[model samples]
Target: MAVDIRTQGLQKPVSVAEYLFARLYEIGIRSVHGVPGDFNLVALDFLPKAKLKWVGSVNELNAAYAADGYARTNGIGALITTFGVGELSAMNGIAGSFSEHVPVVHIVGCPSTVSQRNGMLLHHTLGNGDFSVFANMSSQVTCELAKLNKPAEIADQIDNALRECWIRSRPVYLMLPTDMVEKKIEGARLDQPIDLSEPPNDPEREDYVVDVVLRYLHAAKNPVMLVDACAIRHRVLGEVRDLIEKTKLPVFVTPMGKGAIDESSPTYGGVYAGTGSQPGVAERVESSDLVLSIGALKSDFNTTGFSYRTSQLKTIDFHSTHCVVRYSEYPGVTMRGVLRKVTERVDVGKLAKQHEVTKVVNEVAENRDSSDTITQAFFWPRVGEYLKENDIVVTETGTANFGIWETKYPRGVTGVTQILWGSIGWSLPAAQGAALAAKDMGVDRRTILFVGDGSFQLTCQEVAVMIRHNLKITIFLIYNEGFTIERFIHGMEAEYNDISRWQYTEVPTVFGASDKQVRKFIVKTKHELEKLLTDKEFNEAGGLQFVELWMPKEDAPRALRITTEVAARNNAKAE
Candidate 1:
């Protein structure tokens, strides 16, 4: 027999950057968002060859945020950065992706493997010559980490990390040394598509959990279903809709869970947030004999300071990785499987008649007094009317997050937020990313963003990127002087809560946007807002449109007031 020495598994040769970008393109990443750095410039050159577009951001942090927003809409997104300095700056955005369970592939181009091994001081690294510090920190927030050192192992490592990112619906990290970017790697693995299939559940455990859930589900006289953010993260919104349609049970969403289900469904009740829940929704959810919570994440903001009154014994929680029927837990049973089984097994038509809660009644009249000024009280309801079907709404963490909770979204309107992570200045870049994704996918949808003045200041530079790309986005800039949300939480009159005033309407011009490219409005009165809303040119604009609405510094949404009061009390105790 002839000695087989054909480099083992290597059937063809391709550069490392070529292989990486090819895999990303195969995984539905039409645009790779990031700022180019010295280390990543060479790799960036391969993007065009791979037939991928490079979305150059103003900075690394915004790049990561953009990637996250894209991932939420596009199913998967990828971002690239330079070594330590770049990666560290992008970590906060990565952590937000991790906390909210958005799948993003964070690729970092680093110093050569030889330099890392020899402990040579690199420009992006700390002067002490420790390059491993940043990677270790990233491991905490990422689901998986891969450092490409050997050519033979690089292809497998890349595939594994990207697979984990898709399967878990969370961010993953990949380090590509500068020298490795051009090195030839085996191309045979590229022929096989990345396996993103969810792991098979043990049949016995799946059957047991589903049966137990059905037993509790069918026995109760009054039952409710709560759909949450994880449902969106896990890409099971259709199955959730099926569960609702099949069971005919009243459905409600958590704060973070908003937009995961069709708000227009006849059985759709309202949002549930303990005391913060819509009228009668809390009573129904807490007092029900059985509550089926699918993909529920009971974070602080989602639960209204842990004020939920639902008894655990009456709850059957279906999580991403497991199912919990009261106190009994099934580890291998997933929400996806349980949802399918429930839709197939449950006899929803024969179940007892349940009271159907009407859709959220808008108390604000369509026609208000023209002389009245715009208030937080009047602003949100009007916004509800402005929303259209299939709009991708992005909200900032501060006032926008809480304020949007009260606004009733139309059917097919999807929501994006970082509520659990509570990061300010997140929505701006996120809007850009989402807009790019929507355009890239040929999906006809408008990207609307609600952000505060203070938060906007943090990442305002991304405005240029949006203008450069000519992305169609509508921005509602809530100008309340400073960090109104923070002041409400603590330091009501402190100087630390204040921010320098800027010409909010002139921001587009300052950021390289022309008058024709961006439609700008400064409205301090309700009449002006209403007129602007009705303007045909403003409504049908093909480019960016901005509205700066002025409100009192002390005013806030009802839910935000409640949450801030509790947070302030907690902070007082610490002091």
Candidate 2:
């Protein structure tokens, strides 16, 4: 029943690898991130020939992590890995990207189709002759999975999988056999671009949802607006901001939704996380008569151990694909569509302004001297002073993740963290990818990474990749002795929560960085950090820089401490 693609095409045939990379290049993927393996070597050779830069990473896991960072910044990103071991190693990173709604294409070069048909044992295989195990595992995490079985269907399969990735904002898997990489296929399809546009909204459904939202807004007193992570993921930040401006209501952002809105806005309230929220934020938000929550994700950590006290009956929730007004749910009513309508038609002048809540103030006090020991209380605020406009801030899970919430990000700065998945050691490689993405987009921005010593040890080698590519990245290494977050979660004094110590500042040198090009610092006191932040020459330096700041092992941010206590109690009850 399959129609032959060769019969109707007039153009000359192209290799499947060439065709795939060409399609990726046409669609804005300028670089491919991954490590080389035997199975993928044949396809990797076609990278530069396709006009795509081959960005080699330290490991497949870091490769995938880098690709995720790239995708979020560049709109779409890709990585290539080999069969079995290589692909399996990258699964965790891909899963994180899927959880966070990043668009990434995972192209896996697998064994040749001939070997699979003949049941030949391969070194990377499980020896039982089963080759589909990894792809099956990937299907659970990816939005779509395409295995190139027939040469004629190769182009169609590749194109379809990429389209799904763009539409869903999640990772997709494409498996290419070694022999199939060079198989002849029609090149005429290259002339036609893959449609990446979204389908038009259903007017009736959109109108109904928008009208329902407006009715709730008009009828209630003490109305409040809340923004979450989906506002950024679904590409509706501008619309959300417009709605906030038009309504002129008190607005607050969740921890996951940090940096999506201008925190400097007059109506901007502080972060709202129940008990973990900034002072007076929880009281104002929980007491609201009407809560209009957009792109809300009620994760335990995001909501401070499910601490949101807002009544569901008084809330209207907007999601990426649906709208929920109390108990009634309207499917196919996208938040993007609803926001557009609300921004265009709503008149906020008729709405009354209620008593204003005090703004959450998180400015850091100036350090007295260098001899003063650094603590989480003082360190976060000091780091805030170092931030500049348009900086892409990346934070690792654990202490750095929770600590950064205490620091107010500067205007024009964007924050990236894997809060939902809580993956450790993600920001290091992600910084490399983000820096590269910024460079590719021609955006002059610094990519800053905040990572704990324990987390840095997991994927520290990625710094070498950053250096090799001359990525403009500044790394702040928290030199707390061990796994501080785990200690707060369950075992406060347990030795099992500890990790081995290393010479943190010597990392860049060990990673093949030269002395003149790389700047390294180890600061134990508050004075050193302040001096470094104020140094114009150090701040304007190109290439890589590393700073090791020593803090107490048992110390953590106030929000982290509160959330962990709640988490501990929840865990005890579950057990």
Candidate 3:
């Protein structure tokens, strides 16, 4: 690719968009998810010319979710929006991406450098002293945040943003002032493997980790592997699974990390925290002598708010920091690098025998189906039936939501979730973005969306976009009257938890089709949901279709325990 070059004095500079996009191409990103804005005109101008498609979004929140799905599936996700209003709108989604350990680049165009120097009021701002304060607010949500303030500092600034995100493993932000774009600067070197810090580890914590892991490894009669989604994002699933397979440790997943290893494996203990989580899974973790938690977060939902645990005394918690042993609550070895080394020492033959034993236990749990009101007891296995070898699924947060659907994804199906944000209303918009990607990739597989009513309402407008493009998607909407997770919180049960209910199946026709294009279905019971999923009329529809299933407004699900725990902690922190 070649571009305009301008020379000034002896200093070297480049267009801000060129500098940023070059960094992106260097990192192997070819497509981005975003809605164009006047502030980001430079990107809008150059991205298409560089053969990058701007996957437009209906709203900022959806933009974040869409970007997240793209990045999660394809390895690098990008989102661009205008200044204050746009950035603020996207905060929640990007934060969720951060929580899920998705490597996403958020590029926002802001008031030009000169506009900042004028100190004049801009439209739709909070009247804060400095316009850059908006970036500070975004800083609270992103992993790394910065403003490209001067012509000379732009290259190093962009480089630092990419490098820090690469090093620390979280979302990062680059706030671009309009004027600084397209300024001639040295051809900024793109972000590469060579441009990062040494392993971010605390050398002082090595002994702490050494003692804890070895104790657990030796003491475990039935050790279990608790892998969270972060482990997959860190690209350590194979290594972690290798350790588990070698040691023959049974494995379980948090909702965020579902399907990290083949859930069908004999050693799989099943999902520990979600609507469809197996009962024995949690009890087994609590009963075990050791719990090897790899990249597993003790989130409110993922861990029942960390309320439940395996052997508290001998627990092995591996995260971004040191391996923390429960005995002293002290940091140990840098969990990332140390896990690589320790897993290598595991015994494969012994591990295989252990897996055989767990396989029997797993079969028993899988066979005990019931008609109780438990949602996980109801939906997950059915989800497993619908998935194909190359299907893609997107989930949104809500009551009786996608949290615990025991889905059996085919060999390469990508499961996308908003583990960090966990906010309702992300699925529909995100599914639209994912569909766009599927179209772009020319993959014939269908996209499935498991969404809650509350979340669907938030991003329902995007259905028109899906229909306009004739994207293939199957949406299973869980119809609950309110935010199911909120009711789990202590005092949010009454008016605050209630949400307006709409004619759910009528949504697709209402939003996506005129008299001629809309096709829809109403699923009052499980049978209807099953039929719609299987019937050719429903599945083969080229335009848009909606399937609505009525669910209890009050039935307690496992994720509720998680939400209650996390919400309380967050609320307490707020206080």
Candidate 4:
């Protein structure tokens, strides 16, 4: 009963691998990342025909992490891995992408369909002849799953999986068997690009939600807009910005939502994370009569251990899937449409007039100690001074992540972090991916990474990949002994929280870069860092630059101290 696709199609045929790669190219994935394996060896041959570049990574986990970062910057990304061992190695990275709402396509080159039907034992298999185990495990982390075993249905499955990955902004699992890679499918379907648009909201429900938002907006004497991580993930920055500009409401961002708004704007307020917020930010947000929370993910870290003082009755939440005005929920009405409609119809005069804006100065007191040691308070704001507009700043989930709250970003800068997932070793490889993505997009932006000693040691081998690709990135290796964040959370003097130190500034050279291709510096004092930050040649370096920033082991960011204290209490609390 199978109808051959060749007779049904009016045009030429292409191999399944060719069709899949072509689809990936059309969706703006210029670079595919993964480690090469025997199962995926033949399929990797079709990359060039589709104009895709295979970025050979050091390991599958780093490759998946890079893909996640690339997807965040380049709109969509993909990675290829072998079955069983290779796929399982990338699962942690995939789960992080899922938790963070980044769209990444995970393609696994599995054993042949024939091998599965005949119950033949394979090397990567469990030796029990069960081929469904890995796919079943991947189903837990991905939004869509596509098994391309049947030739006639392959094209639709590929397109559908990709479409869902884009719309939902989460990872998707695609299983490509070794034998099916060469199976012929219709090539004419490649002419039409995959429809990547989100489904439109129902007209009636959307209108009602917009009206309700407007009514509350006009009635409130004091209202504020709180932007969060999903605003960037869901591709609604334009709508959010339009609403912000038209209404001129006091805008604040959560820790996870950092860099979503232009911090240079007059309406921009500082970050508000309950008691961990900047000066006057908590009072301003908690006192507002109406809080328009956009795309909020109130994770424990994001909320500073759930310390938010604002009442839900006073909050109107706007999300990717639904809208809530106060306590009234309007399902199926997305924020993008509602934000657009409200921006187009908002009455600026009816909204409360702006009071004298209190400018929150984040500058810390200068180091008064005679040792001239760089403290966390002094280092972060100094980093803020060194940052340029449009730069992509990557922070590791340790002190770098918590310290960044005090470093206000310039206009157009994109902040990347794993605040919700709290993955320790994500920033280094992620920076590599972000830099490659920026280059692929042809944007003139510096890729900067701030990673602690412990996190850098986990994925430092990715520096070789960056060197091989000749990517321009600035990496500030914060040497504060060991896992400072974990030490603050528990076991301040415990041996388990310690790590051996490395001579970090020599990494680029060790990674096989020439002297001219790398610049290295070690700063142990405040004056040394300031001099390097102001140097024109160092700031505008042509190749990879490494800076080792030495700081006191006991010193931690104020927000980190607060959040860790709360976490320690929660961990020790009796059930």
Candidate 5:
């Protein structure tokens, strides 16, 4: 006899706002981050009352970044904002989250259904009559679902939208019109539990891929392994690392996939495409006997628009879609299934490590620490030291763009970064989503954010969300004024590199992040910074601490130093 010990809830119908709000609790959302607007006041009303906190942001872009970062570290990040202006402001961050596959729920407030037909030129309406701009723009980076026309379908629409998010492992949006938030609706009642578990591979297709890949592997002598953000985000690091070890192939991580395997590992060949490339390594990639790109988007940015010619041998680009072999034999099948079958046949451990390849992996790590400032150099190593068991870290496009060169992590943990869609203000709210997801899954993990001052100002309002939910977060604000990275891009020459200086210490107080019991911190120097970061008072969970490091405007940490140096030279040449 077997017993089912499960928690049960009382069944009762709830209004659209109630049901949707309840679903947040069901999915384990503790707080909502973003600015309020007329269109979204319905959900806003119930948020505080129901014990779910609502955080108001100064701007939509930062709110989106906060939500994205919250999700990267916490899971199920939530952001709510008004119509056109707010939604449009959040575009950059939201799109980045979608590209990075960070699970987030963006609740955008829109004009009422009645208003859609009135032709009255609603307050938030764009120059064009179509409201689809919000949905369409988001659709490119991540998928979105919305229906302002149907009041009764609101709850169900939200439920289905979240379900699709689980399936795709990326960001999803649910547009809510101001009038429909409190409308009546029948909540979706599914008898079958939503399975978060991944399904087993297709046997036949699995065998086919393994056989084809095995044939290629056995023939190649100097095959190079390439992996990207997708592999890292899916928590497939171990499996991927296992495949690398089994084949004894040299591994090259993408900027986002830096820590999938310890950057210090003998098999590590540091990141390619973006980060510093070793002297002969870039050429090696070109002349590699076999190139295996697994779970890699091979985004144009990653390969310099696929610039390096690899015509001498072959490329086995393994993706969710059909596999492209040597850019010739394109076959249909899942890459994981292929790996599964291949593992069944080959004794990968017997592949014997390649000495020359191993040498390259070792050489790459030495060049990773490119940051010049000694005190400022703590970015990645400090990040590595702070790594917890399955801890979620949300990094914005700039921080993520530069890549945590000195950062380290365990074999298969999760992190979120906006690589393709370089969105500045996404890390914050995304961390909220990650926290929400973690709490729901009963996982004890802290959310951390590595962001700069110029970007941090964008979504400064999420501090309220942290306060309301009692979510513990450690946020780092490197106070170097202006858009640091953009200064290196050709014409700007630091012209647009300016931001209003604010007391970084006042963020928590201004946003009400400081309740009677919780505390916040602001550290300026190397000594004070290290003590605060390492001290007992600063690390406690549920405390919102801001360590503000005052650096000259020049203290910008570029992930790709080579490119920055080149840009500097180009700027000098022009002058």
Candidate 6:
């Protein structure tokens, strides 16, 4: 049913672009990221009118990655691109957002409806006059697709797509024909905010599931709580914390769930990724009689090559859309309500009597060697000590991602990684987006990034975007001379893993940052690294800081070493 604009007391009609941008502003998007193209150029004009800043990125792919990062921090993000070429270039990044459950609105400015009706050959198209091809490709990765052809229906379509993107926590594709940019739509519709609330779970079903969970939870002598990435993606940290604090159960996080829990908590155990767990973490988790797994995503990298020893018979899983009690499944019963109800109804006295709270002490290995060279074992722990609360840390897929497992974060810290997607060049642009978001939200949180030299080369130009926005980000570029993580897997000495060396410290200046606006450092020895880490001026620099930390080509994080070996064996077996 079409909504009658005149009946809604709407006297003025706004262009489709105006209506779209206004809705984005209402949803908390302050900055729009993308490149300028012929089709989207007019739509870009409406950004300023909507009180949205345009973050012109180096390319479409990086723009999508930045949108992913922005969405992670700002709650929701949007991007604008041209018809075919622009949207296709951003496919990989959009796919990453889909796989990792990030909410991003990918708006593509396409050809005019007249051009499409006549089957006109477009410059950015596949040269087949087939305009629907690109949108078809995007449909595979995006949760919702909105094609704006009619002015009357365009407003509703945009609202529905954005609603789906937010509620599902995934990317959505919006195709706006160039001709529709000026087509007037009902502006009064913007007065009503899109309903962003998650649908309430069935009350009766929720009660039954909560009872089943409590029965197992109270019956087990050894019960533990395991947290994972979906907990953060689905916005259930508060509920998870409530359950943990009320129950006082031993809480552990998986690798992808690094920053999900406050590590400073007394009952907080270290990361547990099966055999890749910290010291005794695997033993404690696997031996538990009842394991309450919250928002668990058991990916290969997250589980250390599928090495979880915990049995399904002993586990009860809490998910965003469903709950599982051992082998029985309850669909549509989300964790947000269940966890909250469980925390309220759980018998704290009975739990305390049934199980003894075991404090898992996180022990960092000391630098036994008197040599001045920096090692992975020493660097990660030292970095952990340097990190402050509420900091945003972005790590690349290779070594930095796995190395972060050893670095216990402070309370309130947020981690950004692509373990499931494993995109190499994601963190640089992501860090830029995160820093920009922090600035926009007026939060004093510092944005930090850790990227390998090989991965950095892929999207190093994004540093220019950071400089353009004057984001105060700290970047630690590991100079290992090659892909260290790949070497551990199969290419121990392959030339394909090697990368050309560059003066990494000179990047900020080349990226248009003034000397006062940037700080650069090169640390080879342990002494040099320690001095830089402790320097108050370096830590509190008013502008961007880039450090080239030199490590041996062969050295890799302990967790990375084990997981890669397992991956190699699996690949060989498949061959």
Best by TM-score: 4
Q: Write the per-residue lDDT of candidate 1 for residues 1-575, one digit (tens) a residue.
A: 75436455567888899999999999999999888888888999999999999988999999999999999889999999999888998999999999999999999999888898899977888878788899999999999999998888899999999899998999999999999998888887788999989987887888777788887777889999998889899988888888888888999899889898777778888889887676677777888899888888888788777778999899998888888899988887888887888888987755668886667645568436554767776777778888888999999988889888877889888798888987789899999999999999998898999999999999999999999899999999999989988999888789999999988878889989988899888888877888988888776757899889888888888888888877777667853
Q: How far in Å is the alpha carbon of 443 misplaced in model 6? A: 0.5
lDDT of 3: 0.69
lDDT of 3 by residue, 305-421 (tens): 555645557567777655667665555345666676566554444432353424212221452444433254456656666677666788777553444434555566777777556
Residue pairs clashing in model 4 are: none
Which residue segments of model 4 deviate by more than 4 Å?
1-10, 364-371
Q: Mark the 10 consecutive residues where model 1 has the least summed lDDT.
A: 1-10
TM-score of 5: 0.77
Give the C-alpha miss distance for residue 247 in model 5, angstroms: 4.3
Compared with the true structure, all predictions reach lDDT values of: 0.87, 0.86, 0.69, 0.91, 0.63, 0.90
Order candidates by TM-score, high to low. Answer: 4, 6, 1, 2, 3, 5
TM-scores of the models, in the order given: 0.97, 0.96, 0.84, 0.98, 0.77, 0.97
Tens digits of lDDT, candidate 2, 400-484: 7787777777787888888898888888998889889998888889998999988899999998898888888989899888888
RMSD of each: 2.4, 2.6, 4.7, 1.9, 6.8, 2.5
State the number of backbone clashes in model 4: 0
Candidate 6 lDDT, 188-253, residue by residue in tens: 788789999999999999999999998888888889999998998989999999888888889899
Question: Which candidate leads the pack in lDDT?
Answer: 4
Instruction: For candidate 4, give the lDDT of residue 120.
Output: 91
Q: What is the descending lDDT order? A: 4, 6, 1, 2, 3, 5
After superposing candidate 1, which stretches have Cα over 4 Å from the reference? 1-9, 366-371
Per-residue CA lDDT of model 4 for 147-224, tens digit only, reads 999988999999999999999999999999999998888889998889998899998889888898899899998899
Model 1 lDDT on a 0 to 1 scale: 0.87
- Weakest lDDT window of 10 consecutive positions for candidate 3: 355-364
Model 2 CA lDDT for position 106: 97
Q: Output the worst ten-in-a-row residue range by lDDT, candidate 6.
A: 354-363
